[model samples]
Target: MLAGKYSTLGAMPTERTFAMIKPDGVRRGLTAEILRRIELKGYRTVGLKLYQIPRETAESHYGEHSAKPFFGELVDFITSGPVVAIALEGENAIAGWRSMMGATNPANAAPGTIRGDFATSVGENVTHGSDSPESAQRELALFFAEGELLK
Candidate 1:
């Protein structure tokens, strides 16, 4: 019975990705539901934490946007409250998480997506997922140490 259930383990290539429930999403109490949806998608949670983002870390996290005029706002908003940081492992996890998160703007996000159902605007768009494997590696390392994640 157990082996049968595990038969599909190698059916698809597995990858790791990072995801974050931004401050607005955490404040709105959507953490549990968001995690539920992720698990339902067959991804395994390797690491999870809820904590306030330090200013320095937030800045580093958004380093690519440092020259943007709205960069300060991005830092401020992310550091305003507690956020959920998660490391997930599954088949094509990077792309899978992004698809599940939907468009950057909730207004255009399709229904049934996390942002589509929970976000009200681009500024408060509920979630963040790594856009590629390299990005996933960088972001995951920033939020979680090597020994901190489950194997």
Candidate 2:
């Protein structure tokens, strides 16, 4: 379910997207800067945690990429260190967070975006954002359990 905000009139529905500061980003101490950008853009952080991802969880999370040649590398990188998983709520959060994350390949990302500024390579790209609403819901469920999210 989408996260909702209460207004004077009634409940105003808002989108919830999943975002992660990859091991590289966290190791580089970019977590605060990245989170600041999200909050500065007016997204609410409903849930957050820094934890080492288990192999099974990572496999499920990246299940769609199972057939790809780089799948094992992707899983290995993600589980290499602690990552910060966050649940963000806002209007058009899925797209919004993606925009903030910049291009998947840091070489191609623009100067002002997170990846552009922090990442040096595609394999070590510093963040992850849900590409669509459906993915957001599934991702959020994967990282957070019931009652973990704030109202």
Candidate 3:
């Protein structure tokens, strides 16, 4: 019955993606729910950790937005509280995670999405998912070292 879930090529190639339950999500006690959703979608958690992000690491993680006006606020918020870093592996992991996250702005997200259901604003959205495979590799490296990821 579940045979059509993927494609004729059999299961899609497994890929890893990076995700972070942001400060607001942690402060609001939504970590379990978020991770549960990921697991329920059939992805495997290869790596996980709870830690306060250092300023230097935060800056590097968000380097692409360094020139943006909200860059300071972005870094400040992420570094403000403890966050849960997650590395999830599965087929189409990057896009799947992003779809689960919904729109960047909660106001614009659909009703069933994580952001649509829990987030209040763009600045304090519940979670972060890498937008592409390249970003995933980069972000996973930032949050998790080679040894941290399960083979």
Candidate lDDT values, in order:
0.94, 0.93, 0.94
Query: After superposing candidate 3, which stretches have Cα over 4 Å from the reference?
Result: 1-10
The candidate 1 region of ten consecutive residues with least summed lDDT is 8-17
Question: Which candidate should be chosen as best, given TM-score against the real structure?
Answer: 3
Error of 1 at 14 (Å): 0.6
Of candidate 2, the 10-residue stretch with the lowest lDDT total is 1-10
lDDT of 3 by residue, 17-124 (tens): 999999999999999999999999999999999979999999999999999999999999999999999999999899899999999999999998999999999999
Off by over 4 Å in 1: 1-11
Tell me which of candidates 1 and 2 scores higher on lDDT.
1
Candidate 2 residue lDDT tens string, 45-104? 999999899999999999999999999999999999999999999877888889989999
Better of 2 and 3 by lDDT: 3
| Candidate 1 residue-wise lDDT, 1-151, digit = tens | 9999999876767999999999999989999999999989999999999978999999999999999999999999999999999999999898889999999999899999999999999999999999988989999999997799999
Which residue ranges in model 2 land beyond 4 Å of their true spot? 1-13
The TM-score of candidate 3 is: 0.93
